[model samples]
Target: MRTRQRWPILVAATLLVAACGQESETPDVDQNAVATTSCASSGELTMWERSGGNKAMVDMLVEAWNTKNPDCKIKLTYIPHTEMVGKIAQGIASGEVPDLMGMDLIYAPQFEKAQQLVDLTDRIKDWPELKTASKGHMTVATFEDRLYGVPLYADVSALFYNKDLFQRAGLDPNKPPTSLPELRAYADKITALGGDVKGYYLPGNCAGCNIFTVGPLMWASGAKIEAANKGDEPLVGDGVKQVLQFTRDMVKAGNVHDGDRAENGETFHLQFGSGKVGMMGTGNFNITLAREQNPKMNFGVALLPGMTAGSSASFIGGDLVVVPKGSKRVADAVNVMKFLLSDDVQVEVYAKALNLTTRSDMVNNKYFQAEPLVQDVAKALEVGRTPYTLTFFEQINSPQGPWLKMLQRAYYSDDSLDTIISDAKKEMKAIADQS
Candidate 1:
């Protein structure tokens, strides 16, 4: 019999707060007392993770810990992908939160502000291996000068093109398009083949995926959400308008498909696997799914096309493991964190999960060397940058969320590019004011 799933109430609260821009104060901890207590042992720890492949990986980690420690055991909870954030929030609010959690990078900042997380700075300062294993992702897990979590895995978006589609379109399969104009030319060629084929497929519902897909386009074009504050003079100017307009153009050209409305990363993969789409902006997970669904599907991964800058950068998104602020087993938690970061575990877990590793040492491991898709992902990682602020969830879900809608509308409608961008900028300024 299947068990009933309980949604964490705190997650609902988080979603509400994220969407509405409400702030929740972190529970106060007596730092002096917490610092003096040694790590506890033999306590039952609860860990929550998303289902399917991700769940399998967390389970493997738990098993390894249990076999070696014997004294400490973890109870694993599988949360549906759609409900993970809400359930995690519910768990936190009820004081029944998991001892450790595997969370997406987008939610890290929100959790950090709530003081729901324990600072791992002191622990990491002495552990060279853990520091080395983080592969620059620690920056994402940090907020206000405090380290809140240890990265479990890292990933970035890339263009996955069907080699067969490229060849059929009279393009070299070995050399995928590297710039926007080139991509448009190649995609047009693919679409010309007709019959339910689209040049590109990107999800419209998944905002997180959009950050990876569309955000990079803006960055490549020398645009950003805003300019860095170097004592006055705002950095963001007209470039933002230009990038949004470009996305609108892609939509207008029919290069992007409507199928994204009901699908997500997995559904997008199924579509791509069937040869219905020629190119997609997706993550490493798609490589595995594509291989399983159609072993003969000729596909190659490439960095997302560049703009005038002639360079590409992707928004990195993945999971990190953090100990809650009130956990009694801080030492043991640190120990487990260390083990997870070890080279042996990084390669083993990455091999099984097929996710990218955070360590530089693991980039050239035999597993990645054997898979061209993985290798491409590693190459893209070299140019990766996380979103500028931890309020990413709020930034994406707010009234500014209309920017995304505007992009889709501009793409699908006859609206002028300037109108779409001007409207989006107005909305963006409103959201920034709230921050």
Candidate 2:
């Protein structure tokens, strides 16, 4: 979940104050205290989740949960992604917060660090399934070694290639690019087919698109963009230049779609979906969207590769099921979360619907066993990573952020890659320091 909503300073300050103020009225929770809620607890709990493709899955799961536990029901509200943060802030300030919320995992660190979420370390620490859950989501939800949320679903990034185009270009459709040099070589071969078909596509103007799709390339090369620990300074490593140079070379060689520089993510997959672009990097959500755009188009997916061969990674992104602090229905909310994470719901409701399960252990379920693309995604869920920084939006996802600026200069201009990376690093360092 990369979203366009950048939290302003005022709202951030409001959330800090509201969360801290609520903490005063509520007694400090014992670090070892375990919640008494069971999966069968009978009560009503309110929850909020963002509206999008996941809405159908969420609604279906809630209905199933209600059917399973007639005595314990959930009232879920669908809020727009742009309005979620502000609404949550207002809810906290007015004491009108929901019992639980399924929020973007990227924002979990912010809420957890600010004490806006309930600590569930004691309750979830001993659960066997926790060992197999997606590490990226769990890492984002944890603050100071305490768990605050459970993964709701997974959205990982991967390279999508047009299978038909590969065959037409005399390339093996069964074997996709596994490394950066292979990707460039594949692109050159595809571009030589001559026509509107280019070798690759890029959403040049969308910051979210770049971070979600390109971030993993840097990570796969063993680069750490965000600090692993709170007190450590975040560093933009040399792998960034490798990614920038690769993209710039592709663009200069006319291997990328000409319209890519103007794409703002609204039609990110359309060019590739039209069967004109040979490959593109995007999230798992696009598998459905692209198919819907052109039902006859043939595509294949693989984990995005690093600079070297045999290296692969993905940006692990999705929603987390969190119990907001100050809720009277904590027991019921915890019970609902537990029920959702169970094997039955995870397999039947989520995997059956072609959605990635939050738990990696469910990858071998019948649904994933039937789809090879999903199997690749399952592997990504197991190894993909996400930044746990508190200023993710300001530093990476914002339209005016340093990450986007760096991409624009490096990919769309003739500017020196070294200078672009250096300037961006200073800007990122300043933002991280302020946080």
Candidate 3:
């Protein structure tokens, strides 16, 4: 949780075309083309991966696969996130893409459009464990109903509340807020404790902060900013505006931490660590940090409240494993995808990184059963969503994206929620049309 891994600004991916023309067979390669012959004899499987602050996870997976499957060797190379898109684009254009690649889920569709990936749609759904995958995970990995990548693991967001703060505020510790209105009311109660005890904190200056925090409110209110497909209708109601209004009212009420508006990832979590901050909307990893910082801190978890009950949502983060379209070793690459998604990999990876395993079956693991924080987190993962869309990098997360623009207007300017949201809708619609 204290991991200060800051992501540099992500870039918009240029649409890719599939790799064409097969490379001549080399030493250790079968002479018959994989398209003409079975790829069972395919030699070393070369893969490209982004080092998302967890290189060991990649190392462990590759080592495990190589040990067990001697015939299909996996060779992985790390590409910095800032350089991955340009490198992949060049590789695709040159028709020399790797056998498999690991990438952020948001960029998968842009690559898929270029026919730059192996079609995994037929293989992925049949994966019994995948049936338990959250709609958001499945949605992120799919383009035009075709599966393009396998979700490895993801960081999930859930509500973290100090039980001590709840007791002090006279709010029932067993019954946390279940609706957005209740969140404000409960937060106001906790905020009444003046000195250093803030009711809540939402990271404003942080890039991609809203996806896990306010984005869930929009989802719970049954709204989405972007359409999944062209000609699909925009979010039907005023849910987006409602989330904005709730946030604005909280600011006026002074429930948010004093310096919260200026906080990035590090400072935001530090507020919760001080033990006086009553509630925080952040990722599960923060729990580890809170305990490490204050051993006696008694905290609990709940879903991020929506407009109504049973409407909670979460933002899931992590990488997806994919196969490049140019690979002659499709069979072995597909095998690697399976191994990455297998229950064993999910559990082992979680041990090292504490990232929530995306698999539904892993909920039964004894580790989660005994760990209340992780158990609650696993529940959220069952419904967690990715901040993914075609052009997602440009429309939602990049410097000029609408989400950041909307936040700045709502917080730093005199713009009313109505005008801000109306403008956002138009920007989002234009992006959708371009898609």
When superposed on Cα atoms, how far off is each prediction in RMSD? 5.7, 2.5, 4.3
lDDT of 3 at 203: 72
lDDT of 1 by residue, 206-310 (tens): 555566777777767676663211222222555556665666666667786666654434354466677778888777667877888899999998887666535
What TM-score, to 2 decimals, does candidate 3 have?
0.86
What lDDT score belongs to each candidate, Candidate 1 first?
0.64, 0.79, 0.70
lDDT of 3 by residue, 1-435 (tens): 112333322333432432333332312233232221113564787889876535666677788778777766788899887677777766866767788888766667666766666677765556776787655667778877888877755667788899999999999988878998898999999999788888887776664666667778888798876654456544447788788888888877888865777665556657677887787778777777899999998899988888886679887776777877566766666667677666776776564455566676776776666677887877777667775556565566655567778876776566877888878777766776767
Q: Model 2: which residue pairs collide?
A: none
Q: What is the lDDT of candidate 1?
A: 0.64
**Predicted structure with the largest lDDT when compared to the true one:** 2
Flag regions of model 3 displaced more than 4 Å: 1-12, 15-43, 53-56, 70-73, 228-235, 264-271, 348-354, 412-414
Model 2, C-alpha of 140: deviation from truth (Å): 0.6
Ranking by TM-score: 2, 3, 1
> In model 2, where do residues sit more than 4 Å from their true spots?
2-6, 24-40, 227-235
Instruction: For model 1, state the Cα shift of residue 16 in Å.
Output: 11
What's the residue-level lDDT of 346 in candidate 3?
Answer: 72
User: Which pairs, if any, clash in model 1?
Assistant: 8-87, 8-90, 9-90, 10-89, 10-90, 11-86, 11-89, 11-90
Residue 66 of model 3 has an lDDT of 81
Q: Which one wins on TM-score? A: 2
lDDT of 3 at 320: 78
